[model samples]
Target: MAVAAVGRGASCNAAARDLGCATSTVVSAVRRYREAGRGALRDRREGNGQRKVDERFRERLTRVLQRTPEDWGWCRPTWTRELLCLELERRGLPQVSVATMGRALTSLGARRKAARPIVQCPWPAWKRRRRLYELKCLHAHKPPEEPVLHVDEVDIHLNPKVGHDWCLPGQRRVVVTPGNNQKRFLAGALNVRTGKLTWVEGKSKASDLFIQLLWHLAGEYRRARRIHLVLDNAAVHTSQKTRKALAQLGGRIVLHFLPPYCPQGNRIERVWLDLHANVTRNHRCRTMDQLMVRVHAYLAARNAQRSASPCLRRADLRRTA
Candidate 1:
């Protein structure tokens, strides 16, 4: 057995040391291998067992990966290994281990990811009432057909995300070789009421791109009676240059910012979730042009058919225990 292990690429000295009989015992193992064929070294249980994610699972894994978290009523897009293990267990394969669950996701070309940051900031009594009053007034004044748009930015990477495949949990990642020399960003907006999406490629999260995204909305929404923008308090959103650019729009679009640290109120939060689930999971772009192309394609396709994924809605937020 020791010689068989060594012949299969184990170090000879290590093999001899492990078997603990003698180097000559390894010679016996080798002779047995020569006489009895490869099966001489097979363990007693070798042919009697199978792994959990054997042939029966491949189809189920494919369908599971293709479905969004919202499709299953999960309140988040990203799936944890625990979630996967539970899925397998619920399907009557209770033997699936967490490690095996991870392997299955990797084999399906999905990356394990944490939930995105989503916090609803609290407002002081005064500001809270003032905003509620403003919302009430706007609600009363708005025509029945008016719509609200929520806008935000999300980042795409340079490298294919690393340490996400065939990797052990808790292993620290080494490096992220920048995929392309250039960096890119995305500016996105969504209709909160109608679940429509609008997105464009951006050079960076500059005040200019921010303003330009607003301009794009204005041009696209020229016929709407009023456009109320839901926003979070990013520095770019409040930049002087962006404000100047907004001023140039002649008040055609109204900005309704969530209180500080409160990004959950923006409907674009849901759009970004959908973006990753449908397009960005394990995405690879070797060049900046390729990155831009994929992003644009994703945006265009989603704009044509995107629904606000139920996972990110305010109603999906769990009540405090």
Candidate 2:
């Protein structure tokens, strides 16, 4: 409303503040409006030239981004603007400059980011699908008297997990780590029906730690006839010692192993990820005790948050399930 604001005798600075834009922008807009009526308010670039990045180019770029630079016979593993232009040329598409390629990528909402590592299950597709279906059915149709939990373990360290953070233009955030890192391990179970979490920490990520978590789960869910845990095939979870602990617990706790190499199948994995993101990443806690304190505090806060809201708990249960 630069024209309206100027019509009311507001200064360019005042109009700019009202519009949340630069003063010069308001001045230019008012000048244009005065000179050329309302038509000048429309985009002036409409008839400048033929568009360089059209839907066809954007669609091609989208397909290219889904694959890697290596797929197009490039030695490099990652895509760069220059390499993208070259690949487009090789594919018999109209060649563009590096800058044009960047603009096109921006338009397509593509970004340069670190690749996440994933492990594919080695099982045959049918076998994997069958096992996943079984797990889904187990989660959906398990007896109400038996509680199902997604179980996983996480390592906590005196050394902070480094991650990105906001900082001044030329400044970087630093996290100090104890040179000789001390470690703590947490075994956690996330309830499938509710969003409740039960966790126990130990000095080592061993069979003892897994058993301790089992004991905690057994106690926490004492009312249930059996506690069904969906866990990965970690050595600690399948060890002789762990089996003995389970036997001693008298089948009160049953284990359901997920398809091999599929951490995504375990809902508790997301809890561990949130643990890292919220408490452990770039943490300034100097000692193992301090870090553990922070970790426990974060988990406790999370549990409390989950327990306080019924609607949120239901939504979380659905999302994780």
What are the models' TM-scores?
0.51, 0.80
Candidate 1 regions with alpha-carbon error over 4 angstroms: 1-141, 162-181, 307-321
lDDT of 2 by residue, 1-321 (tens): 887998999999999999899999998998898899999899888896778688988888888889998987889988889989988888778878888898898888887788889988999999988988899999999888998999998898788889999999999998887799888999889888978888998988889989999888878888989889999999988999999999999999999999899898898888888888877889887778766766676676688777322223334433333
TM-score of 1: 0.51
Please report the candidate that would top lDDT against the real structure.
Answer: 2
Name the lDDT of candidate 1: 0.68
RMSD of 1: 14.7
Candidates in order have lDDT scores of 0.68, 0.85
For residues 1-321, write the lDDT of model 1, one tens digit per residue: 676587888765677888776777677677878899777866666665776687678667667667765677778766667876666566777467787777777777777556556555577868866775665466456674566767888887666544344558777545545544566788878775556677766777888788888888888888876678777778898889988877888877788877777554455777777666544555555566755565565555555555422223222222210
